[model samples]
Every structure is written in C-alpha cells, then in structure tokens.
Target chain A: MKTWIEKQKALIDFTLASLARRKIKNLGLLLVYTLIVFLLASVMLFTHALRKEAGKVLENSPEVIVQRLVAGRHDLIPPGYLEKIGRIRGVQKKEGRLWGYYYDGVLKANYTFMVPQPDALMAVESGKIAVGATMARMRGLVPGNTISFRSYSGKLFSFEVSSVLPNKSELVSADLVLLSEADFRAFFELPPGYYNDIVLSVANPLEVRNIATKLSTLLPDSRPILREEVLRTYESIFNWREGIVLVLLSGAILAFAIFAWEKASGLSAEEKREIGILKAIGWETGDVIKMKFWEGALVSLAAFLLGYIAAYLHVFRFSSWLFEPVLKGWAVLYPRFELTPEVDGFQVATLFLFTVFPYAVATIVPIWRAAITDPDAVMRG
Target chain B: MIEVSEVRKAFNQGRHNEYWALKGISLTIEAKKVTALCGPSGSGKTTLLTIIGCLARPTSGRVRLKERDISGLPERFLTDIRRSTFGFVFQQFNLIKGLSALDNVMLPAYPLGGDWRALRARAESLLDSLGLAHRREARVEWLSGGEQQRVAIARALVNDPEVLIADEPTANLDTALSKEFLAILEALAEQGRTVLLTSHDPLVVEAAVIDSVIDMRDGQIVGIR
Candidate 1:
C-alpha cells in the first residue's frame, strides 16, 4: 500500500514537470476551460439564487388570494367580499389587500403602490409613505422630503416620505411605495368599500388547497390562487429560461470537448516520442495511463476552482451583468440587489459532471490507445 | 541465456501494406558477453533485438528466457519481464526532454517504488558512475549527444537488470563519442551482465569487445562469426 502511494506520488511529480514543460499550451487550454465554466456557472448560480429568493419572499405571503373576476378579467373585490369569506374553518387570518401599478411618465417606469397590512415588514402611518430603497435613490428623497404623484383623475397628491426601506429587501420592494389604505384609494381615485384582492392565511399547509376549493364554490365569480402554485410557476419559468440558455451554451461546451479531444489525440512528435521512450524504458501501459490521468486531473481541478470562484464573484459582487439581460430579464426599475452567497452541492456536482468528467474522458481515451501500442512502432515513427 | 527459435515479426498484418520484418530467425545469446547483430537498414537486426528484449512479440515461433517460453506471453506479463529482466538503450537516447539527468535515470525505478530517497541515491550513483555527476541536475536538452547517451545508459541500468539491450548505440554519435560509447559497453559487459546490441555501423560491427557477430539480409541470417 505504501509503495502504491509512493508510485502515484512519483507519477504526480513527473506529471507536473511535464505540464510545466508545455506551460503556454496548457495554460491556454486552462484559460478557455475556465471561461466556459464561468459562463455556465454564472447562469446556474444566479438562477438558483433568484429561485431561492422567490421562495423566501413568498414564504410570508397568504396561502390563498381570492380575486373577483368580471368577464374573466381580474376586477376589484366589492366591500362585502371579506365578510363573505367570513372566517373559513382552517384560516388563521383573513384580510383584504389594496395594491395597484402606477406608471410614472417622468421616469418611464412603473411603481407598485400598496396599502400596508400593519403586519408588514415596515410600518407606514396614515398620510405619510415609506418608499423602497431604489425609489428613494432614484428620486433623491429623504425621510422628511415630500413627493407628489398625479392621480388617474389628474389631481396631484403630496405626501411626506416617512422612511426609506433598506436595500436588503430590495428584491421584493425595489419599486414599492407603502402608504395608508386611505391614500392608496384616493391616489387611484378608487371609492370606499373596494379591495384589489382578498387574502386568507392558513396555518396548516395541507389545508390550503382545501380552503381554496371551498372559496371557489362560495364565490363563483372569483379565482383563487394558492401560494404553492405561484411558487411552482415561478420555479418553472426560471428553470425554463435557464434550460434555454444552457441549450444555447451547449455549442460552446461541444466545441470545448472537441478541442480537448483534439489536444489529447493529436500528439506532437515530441510527445509521442516521450511516451515511446517511457514505455521502452520498462514503464508499462498502466504507468503511462496513470501519468496522463494525473495530468488531466490537475488541469481540470484547477479550472473548476478558478471558474467557480470567478462565477461566484461575478454573480454576487458584480451582479452578473454579463447575463442579467437574458437570465434575469430586462427591467427599467431593476432590483439592483446583491445575491446572497450560497452554493448548492447538487448543482455544483452536476456542473462537475458536465465539465471535468468529459475532459478527463477525452484525455484518457487517446492516451490509453497510444499506451497499448507497441513501443517499437511508436518510437520508430 | 536467451534463445530465439524460428521467430517471425510482421507489420500491418492482413492489410495492403503488410510486410514481415523478421523471417524464421534463430540464435542464442550467451550470458555475461557482448553480442552484436549487424545488418543493413531493411534487415531484421533491430526487429530481432526488439523481440528478444520483450519490447515486441513475434508473430510466429518462440523465444525462451532461461528456458521459459516468453513468445506467447501477454503484454502485461511482457512488460513485467521487460521491467524486471532487461534494460533498453535506443539510438536517439530518448531521454525525456525537460527532465534532469537524475530524473531520467530514475524513471525506470519509479514503478518499483521501494524507497524514494534510496532510489534517488541509486540514480545519483549511476549518473556519477557514467561521469555525469556534475550534470546530474541538468535538463537532458542541455546535454551534449555523448552526455545524453550516457544518461540513457544510466537510465537503462538503474533498474539493475541483468540483460542490457542497446539498439544502434552509436548511430547518432561522432567517431570519438562512438568509441567512447563502445568502451562503456565493454565495461558494462565485463561487470557480468549480458550485453546485446544491433548496429550497421562498421565501428560497432567490428568492435574487438563484441564476442559474436550475426550478419543478416532480408530478415534472414546470412552469416555468423
């Protein structure tokens, strides 16, 4: 056992020296390999973080949202809707939600205006508003500043900025404005006794679907949306986008595989002679294979580490600008949030399977073929 | 002793370019003596040397090492035999580029892996014996043709094999270096190790230290002296 370990150590020593001998060529291959890994890993890590954020944000959402439909389109729920929902058996809390999208013609962006639920992440007092971090940054407004927005009825309403939401919640609140329910109704010129939707929070997850079904039967004109279904929809959308990008990137991966295969099989005359000489001097086919394996392993492992670290920094630090337009979609009022640094073992292992495994196979197959041939024939050539 | 009986070797068998390199050749190589196979380029001298050294297997007939048939052995066993029993010196020396003389000498002993420190010591001793102690850490590409040849010789001898097989030992050397190489061969033979060599160079074919000469043409033995 000791001798076997020693043998492998010697092979690794020789392999390192051999790689250094062709330093430029090997380094070029490493650079291209690292780039390929960086591209794929960035897409993967970004998508994974976005998905995790979505699930976490939705974690606090009501299990069921009941929206009144007028001619199959979402309409405002009438005043008596919450009374009609009226304490479903499994529901822990029930309330009406008020929210609407307001297009700011000046900034050419949309802001989500909503009434604070009181159990909201941050408090908003009556007649005053709390703007999200991005909104404050864009408008240069501080807590004491007053901002005005024209109503749909062409009337201007001004309110004091009570607070600016922190950046940590930017993904969910990037273009958000939290005002009192009365202000939200007045800004949209909406009358009293109307809510955008009705929300029911159920303590038991298993009872959510049952409650949703009961609500549908009770309110035939309303559509019930379950939180899990919304989460699944977002999950599928991100996965579909990620899959499309991966398919498009497969061409690059294939090119890299071909490059690796060509590099491994197309031995330079000097390299061929080296193999022949090693074999002739009493090194066996197995020994030669072991040495080549070390060469492949060392190069691939280094590429993986460099690429993954680069991708992590690219996505989390620099916001993965290279892939944002595609992976995260286009937005005028984009989140501009930093992704939390985390690695999914399964995803990384899968990436390893995609990258290093193929390279090692490409490197070993040709070397094994060469090693099995007669040393005399190869040397003579 | 090594024995070759009716051994034949072919290249690209069953193909259009198929050509037999050796034809029904038979000979005996005595222990602790220097023997040379002399022939022109197309002759079977090198092919026979490769076959007897276990670097290539014959297509027909048999070869015996100490009365044990080795012709039909598998490549795994043949490699083992080559590693344990024979050392090879090629025409170009074939010292791996970018490696020091000591590293080249240590290549054959790497698989054995007895003790790395002891192996390094032995490799150093072999290089010193070949008058390459001062050049032990020099990369092979930096060495002269004669120095490279000696490194190859030291590499071959590092495993301490009993049979030394050198193919065209002086093919790449000038006259003086060729003579120096021949003197080294004579000295190794005098150390009670069997030395087998192949060369068409007259300087090697007619060397005084060569105990026997087998002349060949067209893959068949033409004369023996």
Candidate 2:
C-alpha cells in the first residue's frame, strides 16, 4: 500500500488538474465566495475599532455628571450645584459646565457647545472654546476667529474659536463647539448664577453608585450620571447595528453554503462512472476522499484570502459611509472616521474553521459513499 | 491463485425484479494462468469476475486470494488487498481523459510510492514493451480505441499485482485490435501472473491461450471447459 503522504500528493495533484480543466465554473464560484468573505471581514474590523475608540473617550471622561430633568426633558442644573457636589467625601474635584445646541440657518448644520477654559472646568479644556475639526474645515473657521449662530433659545451668539480639535470620537465630536462658562451665559443670555451641569471626578469609580444615591436624596430634582451608563448606551446602539448587518448579509452566507454543498455532492453520472473506474483500478476509498478534500480546501482558501483583502479596502476604508446611519441614528455624525485595518489572527482562524472546514467535510460524504460501492455496479451505470 | 466457493450475488426485487447475478458457483484459477469467464449478457460473468477480484462481496460463501479468506474482511482491508494483489482493465479502457498515457499507467502505483522516478521507468517500460512507447505522452482521450486498450492493459500490469482482472477487455475494439489486446494479455500470463478475464465474444475466448473457460447462464455456471 502507498504511504499516507503519497496518497495525499496524488490526490492534490489530481484535484488541481481537475479544477484547472473547469476554469470558468470554478473561477466564478471563487469570485462570489471571496466577495462575501471580504464584506464580512471589513464589517467585523470597523465595528470592533469603533467600539474601542468610544470606550477610550469615555474612560478619559468625568466620573459623574449632574443634570436637571424636567417634564421628561434633560435641563441644565444651577451653577450652585457644583459647590454642593464638591462637598461630597468621595468627590476629588467638581466643576460647573454650560453647554447648549446651536444651528447654522445658512449651512443647515447643527452645532453643540460646552463651556471652555479657566471656569469651563472639565479635564478637556477651561476658557478656550473648542470646535470640531471637520466643522471648522467645512465652515472655513480657524483658531482666534469668531463664528456666530442662533442658540436653541433663538438668540444670536458669537464666540471666538480657541482651537480646532480633531474628532477623537466620531460618535460624539461631529458638531461640537466649546466656550467659557461666562461666555456661555452671555452668549445665551442666561441669568448670572445659572449653569447647565456639574461634572465631578471621583477617586474611586466603583463608589459612584453609592455617591449618586446619597446625592439624589440630598438634592431631589438633580440626577447623577455615571460615565459607565453613557458607554453602555453607545454599546447598545452599536450592537443593534451589528445585528442589522448580520441580517442583511446572511443571504450571501447561505448562498455560499449552498454553492459549496452543490459542488461537492452534485456529481454527474459520468463523474460517478469515472470514480468507479478509479476504484476498479484499485484506488482506495481514502484516496478518493482525499482528492475531494483537496478540491474543497483549494476553493475555500482562495475565497477566504481574496474576500478578506477586498473587504479591507472596500468596507474598512470607507466604513464611515457604510455605518453612519446606525452609529448616529437621528443625530448627525459630523466627523467621519477612517478604520485602521485590524487583522485579528484568532478571528481569522475561527472564520476559516467555521466557514470552510464544514463545507470541505460535506463535499467528501457523497464521494466516499460512491467510492466504497461495488466497482462493477458503478461501471455498469 | 484465486478460489471461489459457492458464491451467491443478487440484484433488485419482487417477482419482476429479484434476479440473482451469481448463484452458488465455485471455481479455482491457478497461478500464472490466463483464464476466461465467458457468457452471454446477464449471465453473471462480470459478477463472478467482480467477486473474484474483491471488488464485490458475495451474498453467500467465501472467496480466497493466495489462501486468505477475503469475504469477511472490512472494506478498508479489502481495498488494501485489491490495491496490492489485483489490477483491473475495463472494457471502456477507463483512462482519465486529461492525463497522458504514461500518467494513466503510473496512476495505480501512486498509492505504493517509493521512488516516483522508478515508477515512471517501470510504466514507460511496460508501455514500450506493448508497442505504445511512441504514444506515451498523448492524452488518453486522443488515443485510438486500440491504443487506449493497450494503455489500460499497461495500467493493470503496472503495479505488479498477483491477479489481473479484465472485464470485457476487448468489447469496444475491432477484430484486429481485439487480437492485438489478447496478445498483450497472453504475454502477461507468460510472466507467471494469474489473469481472470470476462468476455461475451467467442472469438476472444478462442483466440486467447487461456488455460480454462467457465461458462455461465442466468447467473449460474452451466458448464466448464
């Protein structure tokens, strides 16, 4: 009997020659299979990267935030809430903030604002107002330049841009502008002591829930928000988008599965007779199985590689357009992000095992059954 | 050497269908002899040959090759026995259409790998000896029926099996080609290899230098000569 390696080599050689003979059919199958895989890989990579970016932005943000809820609407807390929240034992530092939404009637764009620099009081900046990089670029605004718009209260407010900031978080930074608390009040014509919210930094984040409970009891109308809650909301939104993508692309996956099964099992009567001839010539059932295995492996491996490469270029590079609706929902996503190509070796290995191995195994079942039959019976047909 | 003891094989069902292909027939083929099993269509000639070659299991009774009972062996073991001990030549030649005549001949040796160069040398010599050396590189599909038959013969003999089985070996060929093919089989028999062949042609049965003839009708051997 021939050694296992010799049998494998012969099987591989024969399989390759057979595929080469049917170039057109095999090539068409390969192209379609690869395209689906590419799309899947790109979506997986882009969504994963977006999750990481959003997490990072939240992690570096304030531990707790105090906002006023009125008639099912989130309103700004008075500036005095800052001093009251600062007195809590676990609170390391507390700062009052002023933020609001503005609209450009000419450009038909929405802009969000937060107090900046000195009294602005967040980890990001103080009195200097920051604007989104994309918005600045689109509107032709630069640092130390004034941009004016109408606030939600319908009052016209103008502020000098302190610096144009890159959209670090595409989910959040798209249409944002920043200013000092005094500037925020003056621009929106707020009373002297009023502010939007008080953001607090805690030494230990795990104690945030306990602290918020105490704050709620002490201050009835004001509510405490944890950064974790914000991050969870973002994750839920992305999870929904992932589900939609999976549903939309599932048809392609099913088509690929069917095509692979058909290629493996749907041998013609002529092909069966040929298999009989080989068997009658003393070829083992294992050799016949090995030949079909090579055919499956070659087709799937080629498709996997080609599809992954195409997805990287088409889906990841231009992901901002593909996924914008899901990420932004009703809110507009201003800074479109470019996904960095992340090849997860484990994920790729899993994909190959899950997607290709079963198909290859499926191809062999019918061939094995036919090969083990009486060679004379096969030849007679 | 091949021994068949009261082997039975059947096919299909009911009053209209349940017909035996081979029925309680016993035969022995001596080592190094060219023996032909001849009968008309549906006479169990091919069925008997398949049982003798270990390509099919009998519905009853035992078959032994070189004193080893092959009937009860597992499929894998039977496959190994077939690979090492038997070589088959089909009526249609059954050459893979895409391969060269040499490749077709060398195929059976692929499982018994040693030096592929040595296998190639052996295949080339067998084809050369059979007057097919000039057509060694030609695709099997492009070859004449006679040429394809010679290639099939070469393939059957390539692995140096103890038993050579050829089913209706010349059914597709002209009289001249059939005679030429029989001449090759006679040469292999002279080399002390046991050959079991099936045929419906009386001319093929008469022209060949066979040691014995087993005649069958209705799946049962009616006479022996």
Tell me, by lDDT, which candidate is best.
1
Q: Model 1: which residue pairs collide? A: none
Best by DockQ: 1
Model 1 per-residue lDDT tens digits across residues A1-381: 999999998899889989999998899888888888888899989999989987887888888999999999999999887987885688888888899998888779889899988687677877799988877888888999999898889999999999998887788787998999888888897889999998888989999888988898989999999988889998998898899888988898778867766765566778877888888888898999999999999998999999999999999999989867666633467767888887899999999998898888878887888888788764364
Model 2, span A72-183: residue lDDT tens: 5788676576667766789888777677777676667777877653543333333456777667777888988877766666766666677777655545666777766666
Quantify all predictions' global Cα lDDT against the true fold.
0.88, 0.77
Candidate 2 per-residue lDDT, tens place, B20-123, comes to 88879888889988888888989988788877777888888999877989988877788788878888887777888778899899888776655677888999
User: For model 2, what is the alpha-carbon lDDT of residue A229?
Assistant: 90
TM-score of candidate 1 versus the correct structure, residues matched by position = 0.95
What does the lDDT come to for candidate 1? 0.88
- DockQ (C-alpha based) per candidate is 0.70, 0.52
Could you tell me the lDDT of residue A232 within candidate 1? 99
